[model samples]
Target: MNKQAQAVVMLLFGGAIVRASLTDMYLRYVKESLRPFLIAAGLVLIAAAVMTLVHEVLRPKERAEEHDHGHDHGDGKPHREPWVAWLLILPVLGLLLVAPPALGSYAAGQSGTALSSQQISDYPPLPPGDPAKISVLDYASRAVFDKGVSLGDRTVRLTGFIASGPNGEPILARIILSCCAADGRPIKLGMSGNAPAGLANDSWVEVIGRYTDRTITDPVNEETIPYIEVETWTQIDPPKQQYE
Candidate 1:
């Protein structure tokens, strides 16, 4: 590609990235903490593209001279690396034409939780709240590895989607994202009783339950997953924040 074409493509890609971040479309792939970084990256890319365009426009004769020099001394063979530049179009098109959806139940079921030794330390006390709203990772750590010592008879509520499980069973599942959807892992909690009848896959539900069993084993890792004795549940609209 020529310098002008390259600069235009860069500008389009940079604008697309900025637009996605501004519109919250970036949340579909990454955590909210990355918003500022993404915006900055997009702006930097845009600035680089604008500078390249300006330099190319103002010094067209110099660019032409350099191009001639590059070929004139050589065998007049074209550079093979320019074709690789086309690969950029794939992500650009993906963002512009068909923005991908967030990883859902299918991906959750496919992945398993792996707790690093560093992450298995003593958890602090739960924050103040009725029922003490807790995260799936916290519940899993306390219930599985800590043997439920921290969760003493406290009524806790968890919010996640229904994942695929054995027939007549309800599995409460959450996706734990480190950086983005590509690095997300699934943390699952099994329910003792059946879910509300006919609850579809990816159905967002708020489960009001307490830790039931500490011996629950994860099907994926053969380690432990959180088990909750269902006190009650209610179907709700998908939350604005989808990942933990």
Candidate 2:
């Protein structure tokens, strides 16, 4: 691409980034904490594009002189870019039109629950609520690492998309991201007891259950997969942000 076309591509790319960040579409790809940086990057790209276009217009004589001399580019009529240069717009169009959906059960199934490799300390007990709401990561750690002692007798509320267990049993899962979806992995709790029947994979649900001693080895990752004795569950719309 010529300088002008490159500038236009930068402008479009920057606009897509800014729009996605402002509208929460960026949450699909990155953590919420990176919003300011994303916006700033978009602004810088926009600024740089504007500067390049302005310089190109204000210094037409320089461009003409280079074209006449052919510079070092043999027989160049203002040195055209390769056809591949236009491919950069594909990502811009994808982001501007529709950001991809958040990772779901498919991602969870491909990689089993992510657990810490180091030995863990005893965890504090669940809070005072009858069905205390807790994050999937917290509950997974307490269940698998602390061995459910911290969850003893506590009815807990957990929310995540349904994933298929090895034997076709449904499991509750949340995709955990340290920074962005690129680094995401699943943390899962197998459903047992009164787990609602016929809950399909990828269905979003909120489950009420108590931790069970039951666990199975994850076939994919060969990690200890923990279980929850579900007392009740309800299907719900997918959350705005799917990762923990």
Whole-model lDDT values for every prediction: 0.77, 0.85
Residue 210 in candidate 2 has what lDDT?
Answer: 90
State candidate 2's TM-score.
0.92
TM-score of each: 0.85, 0.92
Poorest 10 consecutive residues by lDDT, candidate 2 = 67-76
Please report how far candidate 1 places residue 46 from its true position, in Å.
0.3
Cα deviation of 127, candidate 1, in Å: 2.9
**TM-score, predicted candidate 1 vs. hidden true structure:** 0.85
Q: Which candidate is the best by TM-score?
A: 2
Q: Which one is best on lDDT? A: 2
Per residue, candidate 2 scores C-alpha lDDT tens digits across 1-244 of: 6677789999999998999889868888988889999999999999999998998888858665653443456554445456797998888888888668899888988996797647575787687879999998888888888888788888999999988887888888999888999999998888889886786788999999998888888888788888889998899998888788
| Residue-pair clashes per candidate | 0, 0
* Candidate 2 Cα errors over 4 Å, as ranges: 62-79, 117-119
Q: List, residue by residue over 24-44, the lDDT tens digit for candidate 1.
A: 688888999999999999999
